[model samples]
Target chain A: MAVATQDSAVRTGRATRFVLYTVLLVFALFYLLPLFIMLVNSVKPLGEITGGSMIALPQTWTFEPWAKAWSEAQVGVEATGLRPYFWNSIRMVVPAVLISTILGALNGYVLTKWTFRGATVLFGLMLFSCFIPFQIVLIPMARVLGEIGLAGTTTGLVLVHVVYGIGFSTLYFRNYYAAFPTELVRAAQIDGAGFFQIFWRIMLPSSGPIIVVCVIWQFTNIWNDFLFGASFASGSAAPMTVALNNLVQSSTGVKEYNVHFAGAIMAALPTLLVYIVAGRYFVRGLMAGSVKG
Target chain B: MGFLDINNATKSYGSVQVLHEVDIEVEEGEFLVLVGPSGCGKSTLLNMIAGLEEISSGEIAIKGQVMNGVHPSKRNIAMVFQSYALYPNMTVGKNITFGLEMHGVEKSTRDAALGDVAKLLQIEQLLDRKPGQLSGGQRQRVAMGRALVRDPDVFLFDEPLSNLDAKLRVDMRTEIKKLHQKLGTTIVYVTHDQIEALTLSTRIAVMNGGYVQQLGTPKEIYDTPSNLFVASFMGSPSMNLIPVTVRVEGNAVYADTTTGDGSPAALAFAAPSEVLKSYDGKTITLGIRPEAITDPEGADRNSTHIQSVETMVEVTEPAGSDTFVTCTLGGQECIARMRADADVQPGQKMPFTINMEKAVPFDPETENRIA
Candidate 1:
């Protein structure tokens, strides 16, 4: 009788899950509609973009907007020989992601297992900064960067992004580390492992999921940041986000929505490429050790 | 001089002391088990000996050498943790050979050591598997193998079997005992399970509230616990402690209590004058093992002057070779072991005899045994 009840309960659960999937599929389409519309508009001619509906495909597809955006928008390269701000974004974002992820793991390690006076206070400060609005710090950060002679360079932007990125990265790392059994650390200590030895050899190797989270989070944040890029980068050093803003609203003529849509697609490609390449690791990372379930 | 000596070892976090001046000397190649309840500081003392925690005020010496400043690895000690703590990224072979690799053992010798240890643990077939692929018991064996590969001077086990299922725990218990017998290495194990302590230890230390209540051979601790805590903590179907008064009747001291039959049951002891002078008329706790209180005619019989009480059996449990009968006496419930086929039923009045010779007296207020 209990088994029969359990079987029916399972059937009901499956029905519930099927309904949930239907709802989620509808929500996914809702969330993805803008991106789909932009992709379709990017391939359309100028007349098609203005004359047809937003979701309609172009009768005659053209690559003219892509080519124009690549050159005129200075996405591929610029006149100053610095290469367009687009490639510069990659150079800055990659290093920022790597440094932030490594340092995030280190921060998590120190905060969780290692004990020191005022450690909790330091952690509280990190969490406190996450609640502060970025607009409030803009003026002060600009003055500080100007004093340090980093006001209009890639270094200033990377530095600022790392500082803002540490707040969330540390949170991801600390929570994950907390779930790990302390007995493992105690056993490692008993086996004669020092602080860094245990972190590098034991803890870090099992931390694939958290590392992916940190990388994806920091990468997207630094890559798509318009405020920091526009404020801190000047001339050819500015990133694609700042350049896209210029192309969309520059006072040269009426806005060219086709080129703007094409530029937006190019701007979003790096992050999309990363998600596609590392998607497996992303899921595996989040659900590490959950196979026991 | 002992192989390991913990002298006046006490530990405290800040204000509350966890271990109060515990002293014990472990002999060479002796398997010693420290057993107690959760907050008993058995693990704390074990951690202190492993150099994982600082000794609050006392000295811990291994083989007559002070170990306070020595690192855990430098102390020539190996530990098997409950969680196994195997390097998750390393294969079973590398996990077992990690200590050797750390000490820079040559690749060929490391491989040989790994092979020998893996074979000893019967994990030769699991050499290439990561920790995630192994079951709980297998991971534990790998942990033990990692500890054993180094062949350290002393082995420290901190509840290594607590994570296994009941059957696996029993199996691993036997395996650990057999391993200890084969290696004949000095081992200091800690657990809250009394049966494990009784079965595995050359000596058992019963701890409570940061104090070593008693330390003796298993038989000695079981037969003659130094206090009420040791007596109750070290036994299953724990020893029945009845609060009774010792009264002097002429030259003999008799423990007097109301029997289940509503008649006074009295146990007379030819009082050793020196031990009985203070308790001439005061109430004392009479400690008796369930086996000691048995059927009238049994393997060991109490002398006629000892005592006999007739009580209605409240419950009877037949456990294959023996029967456990619980009866009430003097408002306290007492359990007794009798022959499996005893002609007794629930609610039947039967005279259960008490062997006063094996009974010990405890000071009612202090709970310590009256020596």
Candidate 2:
């Protein structure tokens, strides 16, 4: 009956379609409202943003705020011409994502293919990591970092993110590899291809979409992470998120909302760009190795 | 000793044994089939032989060398799995030569071997295509090429054609037989299809309930199935088993039973075995193949004695090549494979000529052949 109703609605309901499109358009506009406001204000002269409506477009459309945000912003964890902190974020994210994804793929491979006695219990323990509040680990993680003498370094931050990222990355890959054909693995074994050879040559090549999903998930999480960055890696090694916070909250004589807007957009731009480039792949990869023909 | 010998091999998962002591000596260049219904441990036995499954006890030897703890690849064997199990990411050439690459054979030699196997399997045109790009038959050919290129002592095929459509399955079956003929390689194949077992194997191990029920050539297995299970399992439409009592009358021995209508009918045995004579007053299963019980004109002419029993035809099914006439005999429904043009209909009296020379008697209690 539901199908029949949908069939008839699909054939005849122009008014229904119009209402749906109108609602969707309204939501799309509603979500874009803040970004629209920020984009408009970021190019306006500082005097103009401070004077009146934040909604109105800039009269002069100067790129001074963007330039200041990119290279001359006074966040100052580094004097590397603007602390662009963009590079800082990338430094933290790239390794964290790569290491976590590779480790996750290996964990997934072992859990699914070379399962041992306590594998389920071990996987369950790792799954527990995904759910544990980040707050629960902060003090212990800080203590461990300090004990290991990696307290405020970029390597320390990467380690923290890698540890935090494994649970989710493993979950994605474990589920994907669980559906991958064991027969192929067996065939590879009979072909005299050892453990790592099969994984590299066969499993890894076919693991395209899941790898994309895993990388995207880890990239977004590690890049935008303010909590870990603030708690663990402060000082010059602070990631873009922590630096962006410093820039916005520093109160350096004048309240430069334009610089703040410009900085926030720059901080959020990499993840947004990633989404734009690989968002479709993220969805496709999530479903890869999941269904068998 | 044969080229490959499974000496009392058994397999178990924890406490539950899946395959019992299975012994079969596969001669070099021989084709051995393990055929049975699902959960009958045929595939498990095949896996045990392939070293994919550990033998609970006993041993498998190839070239008279014990392979008890040998790894599958180390055992010098290759298997074509039911799914064809082609590495989807690799091109056909890469898939076929993967084994050689793993064995550390240099590219020059590996490419030459790949070319030879590709030509042999007629998959030369498919060398550049991924497994996903090819049709099911093409994947099957590539899978076979992968196995063949290895030049292993044994080629194990685990229901390799079970994934194909019926027509393609038949074509591949023929191609496989032809390949075996050409290569003369020892192969141990597992399948649940009886026809495939009949057509492909030089020897067959009919297994059931964790035991090798009977091991024989196709003719021996089909014509003289050692037990009731073998009789019922090996043939399409299966062998008709009728409960009959033996009666000794001077120089002749007869199997006497009632029809579906409770009317008595007696079928005499031609050249009754001495063991069959011992069941004079006891009941036994009369095992007769469908082809052996047919219309008078369709009966085997070479047989010396053909007993005709008039019975009520319960149904007549024309299956293009043959008309299967189902009739009531010995208080059970028996099917006879007659010529397509045979005059037969439902609920009519028909004479189903039973070739008594081809019939075997099984002791009712043990289910083993008495004659």
Candidate 3:
């Protein structure tokens, strides 16, 4: 009787599954409708996008707006477009993500494995950093950036994102490294491996899934960050999000919705690509310590 | 001086002392096991020897050299952890050779050591597989192989066989004993299993609540425990401690106690000690192992001092190899080991033999054995 109930539970009824799939598909379409509209409108001419229904297929598809958004749109008093800011975001996000992830991993290692007095309190404080609103840190961060002589520079933006991203990445790696067997660390220690040697050879080698999680999280967050970009580094060093915002807001003549749509897609492309490549690992990393070894 | 000496060692976190002043000198090639219940500081002692934990107040010396502040690696010790602790990312071969690599041994030398250990452990075929892919026993072997390849001054094992299933645990226990025999390296092993401690160690340090309760050979600890704790902890169907009053009548020593029916009974002692005379008319705890008290037919032929007691068998457990007969002595139920076919039944009168030569008396106040 238990087996029969289990079998029925495992194999849902046809009507139930049909309803489940229907609900799932509806939710999927609901979430994806904006992206569908953006993609549909980005390829159309300015006239068709401004005058026609957004969900409608373009009567005449063109890549001119994409080219304009990529290189020639007026962004922040200049028609230099988002190309420079795309590279700027790259320069900022890459270092920011790498530094934050590595530091987070090190912090996690020390916090979990090389624990001392008040380590839990330290971890609690770091976790508290994750909850602080980005707006609250704006003035203090800008002042720190200014004091460091990095204000209005891509390096300044990188520093800003690194500071912001460490909390989350550390959180990810800490929980992951917490589940990591301290026995292995002790074994390595007895084997004559020093602190950095164990971290590099033993801990880091097995930190694949969580590293992916941290990197993806940091990348998407730093890449899509407009608030920090607008606050500290607002000039030629603006990131993709900031530049895209400018390209839409700094329009003087006609409201180029197609160009704006193109710029938004360009701004979103990296994180989307990141997810496409590492989405499964993200889920797996999130669920790492939920189950047993 | 012995090979490894833990002198006046104690561990405390702030105010609470976990391990009291412990002193144990392990001779070269001695297999010393620290056995105790959980939270008994056996593992803490092992870790201190491994240099994984600090010896809070005292010193540890290895080969006449002080190893208190020395790093675990510098101390020349290898440890097998309970979880096996094999580097999950490394293959078994790499896992075995990681220590050598860390110590800057040449690749050829490391490989040679790894090969010898793998061959010795009969895990040569499984060297390329990761620890995750290995069975619990195989992982245990690889863990040992890692320790063995290092050829340290001593090997430390922290409950190494605790993770395996019962059958595998027994097999691995024998394997570890065999390994110890093959390589006469000094070892300090920690386990809560009394049987493992008995079978594996040349000398067993039975610890309780951080103090070394008794330190002796398996025979000494089993046959003649120093205290009630050691007496009760070291044996299976742990030594039945019966409350009896010592009644000295001239030279003959007798334990004046009640039978199963609450009637007065006197069980005589084979050899009376001066301490037994001192405990005259005073209550004492009598310690007797289950096997020592058996049916008359199954009693040890070598033991000449077998005292017979006719008692009501309150319970009889027929455990395939031997029947465990529970009988009340001095108002407390004591279990006796009998032959599988022994004709004993619950609530029936049966003649149970107590080997007085094997019985020990403990001071009721001190809980220490009365020599």
Leading candidate by lDDT: 3
Candidate 1 vs 3: which has more lDDT: 3
TM-score of chain A of 2: 0.94
lDDT (Cα, tens digit) per residue for candidate 2, span A28-133: 9999999999999999999998898899889889889888887877786443423546777888899999999999999999999989899999999999999999
Off by over 4 Å in 1: A1-33, A47-55, A72-83, A253-255, A277-293, B249-251, B270-273, B301-307
- Colliding pairs, model 1: A209-A285, B18-B210
| TM-score-better candidate, 2 vs 3 | 2
lDDT by candidate, in order shown: 0.84, 0.90, 0.92
Error of 2 at B22 (Å): 1.4
Error of 2 at B261 (Å): 3.2
Per-residue lDDT, model 2, residue A29, is: 99
The local distance difference test score of model 3 is 0.92
lDDT of 1 by residue, A1-293 (tens): 98988877646567898999999999999999999988888888888877879888788888887877777653323422112667879878987888878888889888888867898889889988789888899999999999999888888888888888888888778877877777777767666678888898789987888898778878888898888888878666788788777677666655678888988888999899888888788787677645542
lDDT of 3 by residue, B1-371 (tens): 88999899999988999999999999999999999999999999999999889989999999999998899989899999999999988999999999999999999999888888988999999989998898999999999999999899999999999899999999999998898898999999999999999999999999999899999999999999999999989988999999999888899999988889998888899898987899998899999999998988998999879988888998889989999999999988899999999988788897888999999999978989999
lDDT of 1 by residue, B1-371 (tens): 78999999889989989899999999999999999999899999998898888898999999999998677877888898877888878898988877777676899999998888988989999999999999999999999998998888889999999999999999999999999999899999999999999999999999888888899999999988999999888787888888777788667777777776666777776344557656877888888888878878763743544467777898999999989999977668999988998877999987888877667788878999898
The TM-score measured for candidate 2 stands at: 0.97
TM-score, candidate number 1: 0.91
Evaluate model 3: give its TM-score.
0.96
